[model samples]
Target: MPGHLIRKPDPCIYSQFLLMQLNQPVTWDNPDVRILSGGVEQYTYDLTADTEYTVEITVHNSSRDKPADGTAVSIRWIEFGAGSQTRHAIADRVANVPIWPGTAIVTVPWRTPATPGHYCIEVELAHPNDGNPTNNLGWNNTQVHAAQSPVDRSIRIFNRYPRDCPPVDEGGGPYLDYRRAIYGWGALGAIGALLYAHVGHEGGMGHSYAVSVLAFYAIAAAAGLVFYRLHNERLRPRAAVARAATGGHADCHRVEVTVDSYEFDDATGKDFHPDTVFAGRTVVWPAHVDPPSFIFQPGEAFRDVTFHTDAPDDPGPPGHFNINVRQGGEPSGGVTLTITRGG
Candidate 1:
């Protein structure tokens, strides 16, 4: 330790890391529910007698299976969404589909009940009664929807504006360098005037002044170019926190906010867009709209997704906090948001 610490561990990261390493219950009762899949591994399932519930089953691209279980099935169930209305709101309305490993399974199209309902959905892995029917051999967890708003993004997506960057005055800035560029060389050409003045015994002094002006004029031109580049290079917004609201309108389904990494759940609480948005990375929702995972375009690089998660992670899986932005209809063309992390 010295008078000043240059690079210290981030309290936020350290705090979260400490949390992950701690042993805690990820499920309601025990370690029954856990996120073993890839991105956005949480969901909510709504059950209505006549309504259709669609559950998109994604496997952990890599093998995280145990031979003892042999095969893992992803079954959908409804419970409460963490602080849900009540435990009995969605009394045991399980779908009639069983998803086997290695395949994308979706529940048949069916309408949900006409009455209002709330249920926490989870994917549990069920295996042979090796004697424990209580053991959900599948991925059992509840996911949230996209309706919820995002939470604070101070240390996550927004960081302080860097110093050493040239001060950018929107309307006005120092222009002394500009005037000098076009005319600084004036002394080079102004020599004639100085020579004429010297013919009268003052030219020597005039010539000296002319050369000095010419030299600085050249220097100013180079300096001006450097300044312009720096200004243009400052594309990212200044370090500051800002928030805007958009919803209760006809076109509220399309919301795209550029963030480092946000949690995004679906509207049903069954499927949050992203159950987990690792700190320091950016995520964009409406993931389907973007297509092909990464949202890179012909000329730019970067993808931005909405953070979707407002569920319960009993053991504190950083459950999820998000900020919501309402994006209108489908984009006419694809878009790429370039987010800068640090200076």
Candidate 2:
């Protein structure tokens, strides 16, 4: 005879079902925010100093069941960088969200800062019963510049950290040591030539052998000097100036600048289906910081860094160039310079 056994319900599963019924489900339906450039749909563009521009902030409600009425939207501008930024309030407004997915655009008149430089835009949305507040903010920190050959641009670097931070100089120290080693080798070659001449005279070596030995030394020194000069030319500093702020001492900081170009092909697909292939990636300038590194005082300090680029003479296929700046291996800022070639 077989005995029938009844299985008991798991207490953990029962408790989980009770908790799910008691707690309200969390939904991500907050307002989506975006900042549009003046008179254009573009979110990022260059702004003129002391000039007035009309910027638009668009807010959208994603939840179909929730209607956000009188949603408070605020817009602010800040200096373009990765670290601390001083925010300047642009404007604040209210918008009404319909029951269905709806959008509201708030226009704001912004006057650029007196000092000319790159800036970033930030937008925030506030609702009383918003489900998710994390996605209530949006930032636009990219800028585009157009220029011809011999493009020159200036950027301001600052040490926004509380303590003294040294700028990373990737090429300076090693390059300096390399030059010293080359010089030492040259000196050794000179001394060896003199010794060789004296030994040849004493050993009754012919002038032909002496000439050959001297030629070998000269050839080695010449090759070393040429290689050294070529390396120096490749790593020469374009232009970089550092000036300490008031009450701050001047310190050198290394600025690493990189220029990259990319072209897209519509016919080719990338990792994802239908995605355009990113082809023809040409590194215009490799990542190298001239002057190696710069120093910063104990407090906040500013430096003026400039870099240059030369456009191709042929104006080949249309592509865009990205100039990125990094400090301490962190992305400080960058700009996308677009180039369009006509058929």
Candidate 3:
């Protein structure tokens, strides 16, 4: 009689479709289609509705699983719309596929829905041993436009803009660039009037014109003053300011930049008042003779604490500075200041 045949142990099957004890799990790397001219892999693809296209996905085995035959991969498509529809089994399976500890590319045919809309593609692996469900899925969004064919008058264009770069000078432009000629003519007219008034008149005859020139000069000066005050009030110079904790304290802290007898200036430092203080954002605190302090709390390092000066004429030196963290005597990490603009 023959001896009993010895039995062999079955090989271990490690599933990579889910997260296992290991950190890395199987993933779908890039899902894309070649529809554009450059053939770049794009998450968003434009598709003509009611048409069929080829979609491809890369399946990566990031686990310590060994390659096995007869492994399956599943693919699906989701349409985003009123009801949010989903199409299952865009590709039912890639049967008898062998995948190792690397990546395998799978291609399938995807037919666009009859109705034009936005859609997404989902690729998944069917490994039974996959424990991490999070990384096992991948998706892509696609834009579907109405089918392109013979033009129909019934179709309406919802958005419109000037596509030509050069304006026709038909009266207006999108911006102020076309007014160069008008500005030049106005400047020449003003210079010609001034020259004619100066050179064309006798001493006695020039009196009235002199008076007119004086009046014009006075008006111009007044306008200049008004604009100067407006500019100073509106545009305050800003400085790059940062504050951080020098000590290794884990607790949060506050920094205060105090101004005496004034408010904070605007960020541009153009405008100054006794009632406002420009902090990280343009803010106006109440005015006080004692000194108004702008306070900011920093939970972490490198907080922007620099503020524009409240100087009346220009951003002169800020008066009565206070940099206290956690209400303690002083902070090891003080503020550093840098001018953001040249005078």
Candidate 4:
């Protein structure tokens, strides 16, 4: 009998099979990107025009077996405004992501534009074999400002869409129509006049009654026209209806406002009190206890919100704070105000 033929599995085929079993899908969603003004602890601070800052992009790998050896990150900045923004490239960086819970933070130096105004930051990641590419892009559009004590800053909340926004419904319907009610009142005035005319009268009483009736109808007509004009104004495009339900027919959309204070160390670029870094800061306007919410009309797309902070006569150490506004739990806009204590 011929010797049994001995065959061995091909090394290349075996390696390919092992790779297929061990490799898993990679996603770019695990990374966290931020724009740091000073150090890492400073979180997100305001950026000054014509100044250099650092952009930190932390790339994380969720796969335990596979590691993302080399990942590309791109940073860009855009002019501060609503609607379509023009993006300008800042810089590109490469980060090495380790396996499992390990993360690689890629920091890039950025020089802000000379034009003095607020700006928006954007960061993007690219990988050769990325499984999911949807979450690779991130945006930092929060505005930052620096002011001295007695801080009086006006924050503009812009509604990009050209349409009216009604107040969020809470049980009962929040919308109202004054046009119909005014019309009803006018009709009633007419009926009252006709009834007086049917009951014929003579001399002074008749003249006086006729005059009163004419006066009443005249006032009603004038009031109707006034209400009509006001109604048309509220219905204009991009206006925000923010009237209280009990006050008027037009109810504006409401937004939540939040303020946070932090004691920052200019030397180290870190917060002095890390434990209470995000504590609420006291403000003169928008009472800390009963902070009033803001409303947007239908046609008014851009609205300015002014906030005041009465810093102590001897305002402790130099610090900074941030004002954030949200609509329906979504961030509409915000500003980081750095306190500049005057000597």
For every candidate in turn, the CA RMSD to the true structure comes to 23.0, 24.2, 33.7, 23.0
lDDT of 4 by residue, 1-343 (tens): 3322322111000011121123211111112456666675333425567877787776666456556666777788765432223579998877777764677778888887887777756677777755444446555544333444456666556654326544443322222334433455566665667675667642323467667566556666667656655656656432333344334324334566666542222121244453343233453333221243655555656666666776555644544444555554444444545455544
- Best model number under TM-score: 4
Candidate 4: worst-modelled 10 consecutive residues by lDDT: 8-17
User: Per-residue lDDT for 212-284 in model 3, tens only?
Assistant: 4554455544554444455444433221111124333212222222222212232213454323332222212
Expressed as tens digits, the lDDT of each residue in 200-312 for candidate 2 is 55343445655645654666666766666666555544212233332344232334555555432223123433223423356553322233345544555556555455545
Candidate 4 lDDT? 0.51
Models sorted by lDDT, best on top:
2, 4, 3, 1
Poorest lDDT segment (10 consecutive residues) of candidate 1: 8-17
Write out the backbone clash pairs for model 2.
169-292, 252-294, 252-295, 253-294, 254-293, 254-294
Candidate 1 residue lDDT tens string, 1-343: 6513332111000111122223211222112222222333223332344544544433221122222223244444433221111122222222222222222233322234456653333444333322223323222222233232232111111101111223444323446434543455343445645555556644444456556445545555666556654764453233211112222222322234321233211132333233342223334322222221222232222233333323232332233222222123221111112121211
lDDT of each: 0.30, 0.51, 0.36, 0.51
Candidate 4 TM-score, true structure as reference? 0.45
TM-score of 2: 0.44
Better of 1 and 3 by lDDT: 3
Better of 2 and 3 by TM-score: 2
Clashes per candidate (backbone, < 3 Å): 60, 6, 20, 16
Per-model TM-score on C-alpha atoms: 0.24, 0.44, 0.30, 0.45
